[model samples]
Target: MNIDVGILANARNECRKLLTEQVGVLGVVISSVDGFDVASAVTRDLEPAKIAAMASSIAAIGIVVSQEASLGASKSITVNTEDGFVYITNIELAGQLCALNVIANSSAILAQIIYHSGEIKRRLEVS
Candidate 1:
């Protein structure tokens, strides 16, 4: 992704909102499809770089899985673990494709998390 500074700033700012305003959001990562961390806000000693790469891989697999199942183009992938949940979706920043990864605490409402994930994608998009 050809990440522009303006787009990066917007992403960073949105990530901050996820951390400060949104409850149950443990981390937010916006990474290039090639596995580069473009912008992120993480807590509790979470590593953004590692998650960024994994998100890219996960998204790639999602795309393949969707194609194999004839499910059309995949937009996102969600993972729920025993302790928490991870949401990974594709976001376009200034026409560049990137992954928007959100981690939520176990106590988080699943519906709320999904709703805010859409909001984050809408906010981070550059026209």
Candidate 2:
């Protein structure tokens, strides 16, 4: 199925909005399940393509692990480091698979970020 450019633009705006509204957010990306970059809002230092590819792999791993454990489908995967957090979540809207990825500083609140991220994922789903 073909994705609408207008929808993609709106989704990218939503990503930018997430970055602006959230605290400590360094970047945000929306990528397809097959590692294609859909839309992204990132800083100069971050490479959107690379982030999308890595996030796709991470999301795939989450899905696999969930299936192996019989835990049903994975909703999100988060990686916390000493200085940053990487959030990768599956965007499932009418079975059109996509991934939402965000990078935030260590100071960011995980609960808030995850909560808002879920909302962003849902918004993207409609597009």
Candidate 3:
């Protein structure tokens, strides 16, 4: 579990690729558990670092709420809207948690992205 910065960077790159190429996602971000952006594939106007920090905060709140409600371990969370869908998956590497956000049309596609991202995380963590 000797996670390095390079490993995290690779994970983020893989996440971006999965979202753009596999899931047809408009944007993707990998953020620290505390809400710092590690990597992102967003427009220039959008501050990915800020978004990552906000997402991490939201995830913290979500986790607390889930815990309070006895929702058990959170695998992933999805928010759907008329415009599109937002999916978030908690990426646990070593002892740190990173959040992956995928903006897409279909939940199935997002799930696939998250699944693949998880696999990538596992590989990076062990190797």
Candidate 4:
């Protein structure tokens, strides 16, 4: 449970890049598999702790369903609401399990989000 501050700082910086570059992004939260908020770059209205917990729950369910259905590992889960979308992706950074949760407005482009998420994953895995 003792997460390194440097790792957290890096995570936040990565998320910040995503949010700043993607105009439709509302927030980003990076959390441990156990639902602990490791780092976040979010709008003022968001509660990082709550978002992390909910995102972890969603990702866990995605993994469970994938296993039960005999599919491969769950890569990501996208939930679309009336006003926006929530995209949750499981990641491994610095050999530790983590989750990247992104909130985007209705104007967000799904393809762009998907592509950038993949790039972010690769960058995170290497760094």
lDDT of 1 at 85: 91
Q: Please identify which of the two predictions, 2 or 4, would achieve the higher lDDT against the true structure.
A: 4
- Steric overlap count per candidate: 0, 0, 1, 0
In angstroms, the error of model 4 at 27 is 0.5
Alpha carbon lDDT of each predicted model: 0.87, 0.84, 0.71, 0.86
Name the best candidate (by TM-score): 1
**Model 3: residues with Cα > 4 Å off, grouped in runs:** 1-3, 43-45, 105-108
Comparison by lDDT, 1 against 3, better one: 1
Q: Worst lDDT window (10 residues) for model 3?
A: 105-114
For residue 77, give model 4's deviation from the true position in Å.
Answer: 0.6
Candidate 3 lDDT by residue in tens digits, 1-127: 2457787677767766765576456667877887777767864456777778778777887888899999997767777777667777787665677888766665346557667767766775675
TM-score of each: 0.93, 0.91, 0.77, 0.92
Encode model 4's per-residue lDDT on 1-127: one tens digit a residue.
5656776677788899989999789898888898988878898899999999999999999999999999999989999999889998887767888898999998888778888878888877877
**Cα-lDDT of candidate 4:** 0.86
User: What would the TM-score be for candidate 1 when compared with the true structure?
Assistant: 0.93
> What value does the lDDT take at residue 61 in candidate 2?
88
Which parts of model 1 are misplaced by more than 4 Å?
none
